[model samples]
Target chain A: MDIIEILFTASFWAAAIRIATPLILATMGELICERAGVLNLGIEGIMVVGAFAGWMAVYSGTGLWAGVAVAFIVGMAFGLLHSTLTVPFGLSQHVVGLGVTLLATSATYYAYRLALPEVTSPPKIAAFQPYEIPILSDIPFIGEALFSQTPFTYFAFLLVLAVAVVLYRTPLGLAVRAVGENPSAVAAQGLSVTAIRMGAVIVGSGFMAMGGAFLTMSAFDSFFFEMVNGRGWICIALVVFGSWRPGKALLGAILFAAFDALQIRVQQTEIGAEIPYQIFLMMPYILSILALVVMSRRAEVPAALMVPFNKGER
Target chain B: MNLRKNKRVTMRLEPIENPTMLRRLGLPAAVLAATFLVASLLAMIAGANPFSVFGLIIKGAFGSKFAVLETLNRATPLIFTGLAVAVAFRAKFWNIGAEAQLYAGALVTVVLGTGLLPWPAFAILPALFVCAILAGAIVLLVPALLKTRFGVDEVVTTLLFNFIFLLFISMLLEGPLKDPMGMGWPKSARLIPEARLPRIVDGLRLHWGFALALISAGLVWIIQTRSTLGYEMRAVGLNKEAAAFAGIPVNRVLVKTALLSGGLAALAGFSEVAGLKGSLTLDLSPGFGYTGIIVAMLALLNPLGVVVAALFVAGIFVGADSMSRAADVPTYLADIMLASALLMMVLAIMLTRFRVVRG
Candidate 1:
């Protein structure tokens, strides 16, 4: 088949949206956290922890929703740890973030090995099956692409709207944006800056964990060491590419996912098979950098981002 | 007015003018002990006795001459990378791309060393060092240039570059550099005998690379403490605006520090290739670049302290590997221990910087 014929298909579009779901979910969480003036470098580790915890829950015969709940809890715990260190203790954000990642990633590996020692192949569990919306499924190309996804994908899109509303409409959301722009101003207004930041991080991390849980429970049946495969980092980049907005971040995620879907499909085709596949894999990362360079020119980042706020000190 | 000003001067946490020797040493020691205690809990969770696990680690890392040699061998690359990170961090350049720089260096070394040129034996080592360092520096040039010209966040750019270089390596390995006789496994051709570094000990994998690592650390220390470049870099790190106002070329110093960081990390790749693992494989560095960040942090960004810190981390990893083989303890426990230790140390640093006072 011609490359154009292969690219123009409902299945390809469906795959693109499905692939973008996790990025969309994770980027929203990161956007909220960054909006609160803290960068959670621990997202990568938190995702891994969530993926493992959720996988274990499902493996132990718990329902998929239960697995997702477990992931949310684990993600919150790690986020709490990150906030306690970076926000209250006034430690270097980058250092603590890296430490958390190393610790969480390694701890997950150790625990996985301990749980399933000497297994020849990875243990498996039944994954979340796709459920189609009744009337929406009957529509043309857009129907299959948008409506026939796992429940998690549906929740991810809904979350984009929910986050946008929460960030723009509510008193708590105003406090979060104010804290990111000027924490001292928020503090002067009698709101506890630390509390608001901690809340944003915890809530954001829950979404991140949901993304991880979705990966283990929806994308695949079993957990592997490489399952996350830098999606967390990609989410970080997408946040910047999206200019810290929910709708833009969702669009950016979908774009990158389209590229991802395209690459995988091209790799399997005769015309593209002669070229090494690594070139295709490199495209998304390179494009992220270029996009950042362009988008960053007009990007309005939080003023206090990455700076530790000590209430008593200047 | 004077009475009101005096009343406003309430007791609070204040920065120490000069910390006592006991306070300086006691804090890190206490943090270390606490980290180990937490790590023991992890061991217990894994169904292993913590004490025996610690004993096994110590025995495996430092019990005999062979173990000690192995520890030093493991530490050799860490020291180079640690110093590389320390130098850049000292200059406030967040060069998270050392991992990529190391790969670039190793790839360049393999490309130049594998019968590419017929240089004299005495000239090959020096040629390799210069070429590798230059290649590593070149790898970081784009990021440095972008940061200097456009104020790009080096952390994101450097990190993205790492993935690019990794894919580049995979492409090279699977295609042009694929070994003909390896039965389909992707790797570069083995280095010539002259390209291989000589052993430093009687019967150990330890090589002259260890000496090179120590020497590099010492030179970095001197450069950071006793040289004009070091002074400029530190000035830039401390306050770029003030440094620029003082006629110090801020961008120049930052770019130079970045190149230096890349060069030093590339030398780490050279050490690995010349000392152990004579051929270039994708696995030549098992996240040594990332570990170097931990090492540099644990050392408080002191150039000379990186040598000691790198050796200590090397011992932990080497010990953990052997412990896993000798006992039922999983090797990942080492990662947990290292991470906790680093976090604890950061906390201690904060504590040492400020003291709580009664009102």
Candidate 2:
């Protein structure tokens, strides 16, 4: 099929939304962390831990929602370790973040081996299935593309709206924003900058874990190595592409996912037969760099980002 | 001003005027103990006796001549990558694309060594080495330039480049550089015997790459301690604003750092393909670029210390691989140990300069 013809198909849009589900969740997670002035480079490994934890929980006789809760809690536990080092001790975020990633990934792999020693193939669990809304499912092509998705996708969409409202419309959001931009100002206002930053990281990391859980529980049934596959890093780029805004970040995720879906379909066409398939795989990373370059100038980074705040110190 | 409102007593860090030698030595020792403690806990969780696991690891690492040589072989690539990270991090340039640069080096090695250079061994070897360095250097130069000119963050760009370059390599292996005579595997053509690096000793599996790594480490130490560029890099790392005020070209120094770091990491790829495998494959250096960060940090980013750190890190990996066969625990315990050691070492380094006081 031609490019325009593929774009017009409902299946293409449905695939695009499916691909964007994880990115949207993870981008919002990263947005919350960066907006709080802590760069969580541990997103990649935390996502791995999340994928494994959620799947393992479901396989071990828990409901799917309970498995997601397990993933979120486990992710938050790691976040606590991260924040304690970075916030209270005021360590280098870069080193600590990388260390956390290494720690989380290795720990996850170790646990996976211990849990399923005799099995070569990763066992699958009963995953979340697509749920069609009552009235929306009866509508035209747009309904099938958007509304007929797993409950996880609907939750992801609602999350973006919730995050947007909390960030701009709530007092807690103002305090979170102020802590990232000017911690000393927050300190002068009788607020504990440490508490806000730590809280933001912990809660944000939970969301990131949920994104990973979506892959295992919604996108695919089984957990495997390399499945998260740089989605967390892509979400980091999305945050930059959105300039750290929730609504814009959600759009960026969908746009990126569209390109991803397009590439997968393009590989099936006659033109794809002539080119090496690896070229198609390389597009997302290349586009992320391009997006960073295009938006870097206008992007308004948090003023205190990566700068540790020590009370009563210059 | 809000001290009256919040009456809770909290601990704070105060810089110590002069830390005693014992405090400096004792704290890191304690941190090491803590890392081992965590490792033991993990082993226990895996249903293995912690003491036996530790014993097996030590015996596996240094038990026989073969085991020692195996460690030395592993350390060769790590030394190069560790030095790459040390140099760049010392200049405060986050060159996380060492993995990409390493592949670029290997790609060049295969392209030139697979009968493409119809010259004598002596003439071709040096040409291949120089070209590999240049290829790796050019790969990293793009991100460095982007950071300087466009205000782009190098961390994300460099990390993203790793994925991009790996795919690019995959494309080459499947298309232009495919080994036609071999079975249907995605691998490149092998280097001719003349292009291969010579073994350091007769009947020994060890190659000259280990010697090259040692010499490279010594050279880096000299550059870090005796050269003007090293001084400039340290100054830039310590404080960029002060260095710029002191007439140091901050951006130029960062670009130069990218070149040196990328070239060093590329040597790992060159050594692996030329000195060991004689052919390029996808899994050439399993996360050596990322592991280099651990090696560099554990060494406190010192050049000579990186060599020792690489040896230590390589020993854990070699030992753990052997231990896994004899024990129920997984081989990933080594990674967990190194990561925890890195975190603890950084924290210990900070504690050496400061003391905690509860107020």
Candidate 3:
């Protein structure tokens, strides 16, 4: 009816939560990788492969859980490739990440065509449904948004807390952060920098893949070409916007998701009928760029980012 | 010279001051072989016959006159984009917005070609080309400025600008620039005959654009090796702090090279529009900008090597398309092969520069 009413509705918040889930998942994954000094541009392609893996598993008569498991494993494989190139081979991270993305996206498309063979309508799977927490569901406005969500959404929120705690509190977390800042110092302390980086990549990539699996499993039932729709790239921006903190990253995800939800809702209203919808789609990206420019001064980029560590070199 | 005899020193790995020609060539060859083996395994996993697919690719890319011409035609735009990428990467600018810059060029050309200018038939192509290059460069000016002035990361800024350009183009096509007589399709009006690039041959689709691509490559090589500007750019690329210490204007070098890079990438769109399509449309570039990065990297950002690398990369893509049609293998096999090849090439280059020592 009215703009304020539209923004405040329960349905709007639910939509925002739903839209934000994948972004949160991706941001969480990217935070770990960036924290460890790897910019995995392969997230886009990994997500596509993950989406495909989940879709194929379900299409091939497996359960939804099995599909998600397969997706996570597939994502980790790409992470391993990135690690091999960047960690041990000491190659350029930007080039390697882009190459991995191209490879994964192409491989996913090829596999989908070979296995499915039919292109009339895309194949679909029975997707994950929302599970409402019993008592939590009874609350008024925020209940539907926070309590009743796909299993993945709840897991995504829990992951934000988990990542924050692990990153700030644990020795392994300290090692990962230390390696990003000063790999030489970490090496002198008798820790395997490569091992820690490799672990961070694999774990980060698993979460990235889970984000994709969630898309196919919960966001929508079927896969399509470019369904990830630059969310992986958005996640890259979010990592910077969030200032590499899990709490801030989640807040950024929610902010983006809210705008996304608003766009979809506004597109259907009478007042929004006159405007071109592309403007709405462009909002999040434009906002992120502005935000990055403003926050870049204080943002703590890893000191050793994009630099390959040669153990003996200055 | 110590009174007590020192323990004999063991041999240690040292970085070579200059590698021989043979090592340079052999390392790349080995890397190619390793990547091929890996890609073959991937193809097998995808349920295709790897040997047959490889054979088909070679045959389809270069087995006949028709295939060779097609490969070159596909390679025309890549050469421009590759050079664009090589130029920026040589200066260490890393402009990833070539795709959008290409679109910007195409947009300028389309707007001008569709009755914006009254230039004579003989002058339209050159005018459009120049304008498009300027438009492409202008589109990147903001990012370059931000990068130099504010310490913003060019990679992110350029990428965000790409989405902006694409959306802007989509808006134009769907709103003001829609074709008036395509029976409701959202296409632009075809370019006038005078605006089209003349074909180089009677029967083949190859145009004068191929010559432009070659000349651009040669010019890039000359500029990179012989010119003062190129020297400054390279110096900046190697180390900004050192270049600044050496009295080079690092910011000027970065901004100017980025403009040139964007201009070169835009020329690709100009060639595609004038030579092949003769009009603007959605999906004009099949990720040529991204592929350009691969081509440049495969050549190690050497300008002359870019010519060979672009052709090689284009051949795989074109050949894979043919193979998919003829042998029923998907075109994505080529992508897997290309990715592995790039990975291996970069790995080989790095490995050749450093050797392990037994301490």
Candidate 4:
């Protein structure tokens, strides 16, 4: 195996990065909400909402970028709905998440058709066009693979720093973390736990919406039934694997992308021809569980990840 | 929503409000009334008479001998998946991987149906069923292991496997397992006759798998009620710390439930291969596993209730399809109907669980 040959292929890393972005966005979204003490198991449905909303926007003459904004709105709406069910209604997070998934599924399959009967075709607009950096193009393989990408590519990286600042430096961030750790203690100070969490959820879902927007307006630019697939759930797993850190989550996404890329490569070549294809395809999941087992000891899991805060409880 | 400190501490130790039978009956009636009214409105929109269309949907779904058979064929897989979900729900576990488990079961069915087993037909059917069950169980082992050992959330993990498992199946069918008999399509060889689940009431699609599913539901009911293990399991579900104090292995109970859930979902796959398709198709379950969650919840996780609830769901589902072909209404509407019903059911459940009174 010539390392040079593997490194030089544009198609290889492009597809890999494309495959990983949705997971990255979804997990990043999960990270923010998780840090705020609300472990949103609803990211899956949130992404689905984005996928449908994005596609519907495009199918009705709005461009792909318009779809991106629409998806953001849709994602926020899901966050709002989840907030009402969990925060106000006192529903179980797991049950609410499950219900949201079913709702999203129904919405994706039916709501779009109900809303847009005129669009005969499943929306297939222009995806986000890729661009190569001019100065960075001088350096060969690494620069091309790393820098030459879409606007969301840069946003995803920038979001890590932004979220890190908000999580650590800001007063709101401190309040949010304090709430997660001990809501009663925070409530004693008169800061609103409900408001901060609702804000976090909306912002978190915006990140997830970008992920879904990428799937529709960037990844393949067409909406299929169950198109978001299970990347949202995978993102939830990444939140755990990434140890609730945005930087570590980017690495996990890239690592997953690498595995997915390798699967495609194997499918195209004779090297892994002897291996049963099903076994090879499941490599990413197998590796994820294995990585989890090895990393769980070192991971700084949130002390109050999914423990629903009941302020009045003893 | 009502967070009262006085009620939180020791008030729960004493019984408060018990829901009356009229209120309990009212919830289901509301759902039925809403569904019929909504369906009738949709029928009018489609330019068909509401009453006549409603009749047709039911008649096409269950009116004639053949239509009734079709409903049974559709309902068989739902029974298995519905029961699988009911087990998890009773234990307060959310198992969303039934779709993936069903696929895993289907993958196993293909392996046994086509791969060299060196066995007779009668032996092959039993072997295929066992293999399918094993496949489904294996996928669930990860989530169970994660939950018990690492305290990772199983809901996300099991749900993610649904996507991963389906992709693996797609890769297999397209590459290594591509049918030798077909010209380029991603399918496998038809099952050997011995491996096929026998048909019941010939000339219709009803199969022996229906009998197996109903019997399995009975078995689940027995295990959940009559057995000592059931008592311990319910005790763990009711209060994990209390169960642990009483020396029940809480983790072991969860693991067992997870495995049983996976196995039952896989059995749904077994029926699909053995009775419906006669071979593994990519669309094995038609979201039966996902729909099973709604069914199990509607049934309140009672195993016996799952059968009746599953049949009702299956009826609506098949009826939706028939209505689509006959009345030009989209089948996707059924999904919307079910989701709305479940959303309403949750509120109804919460209301039924407790009563609020002004102090």
lDDT tens string, model 4, B226-281?
Answer: 98768876887788899999999889988888888899999999898888897766
Candidate numbers sorted by TM-score from highest down: 2, 1, 3, 4
- Highest TM-score, which number? 2
* lDDT by residue (tens digit), candidate 1, A140-255: 99888989999989989999999999899988789889989998887677566767888888888878877887888898888889688778877888998898889999999999
A1-314 per-residue lDDT for model 3 (tens digits) = 77778788988989999999988988888889888888888888888998889888888999888888888889999899998788856677888888888888988988888887768778778998999999998899888878899887898999999999999998888988987889888877866667778788888888898899888889999998889977888898888889889999999999889888888888888978888877877887787778778878889899977776765566
Report per-candidate DockQ.
0.43, 0.63, 0.38, 0.31
Between candidates 2 and 3, the DockQ winner? 2
The residue ranges of model 1 lying beyond 4 angstroms of the native Cα positions read: B1-13, B356-359
What's the residue-level lDDT of B122 in candidate 2?
87
Write down the TM-score of every candidate.
Answer: 0.96, 0.98, 0.95, 0.87
User: What DockQ does predicted model 3 obtain?
Assistant: 0.38
Residue pairs with clashing backbones, model 2: none
After superposing candidate 3 on the true structure, give the runs of residues whose Cα lies further than 4 Å from its correct spot: B1-14, B46-48
Residue-wise C-alpha lDDT for candidate 3, range B1-359, written one tens digit per residue: 11111243222234766877777899999977886787678667767788988888889999999899889988999999999999998888978889999998888888888777887888888899899899889888878888888777787777777787788888888888888886777677888888778889888878888889999999999999999999998999899999999999999999899889999999898888888897788889988988998899899999889999989998999888888888766778888788778878887787677665643
- How should the candidates be ordered by DockQ, best one leading? 2, 1, 3, 4
Residue-level lDDT for B296 in candidate 4:
82
Best by DockQ: 2
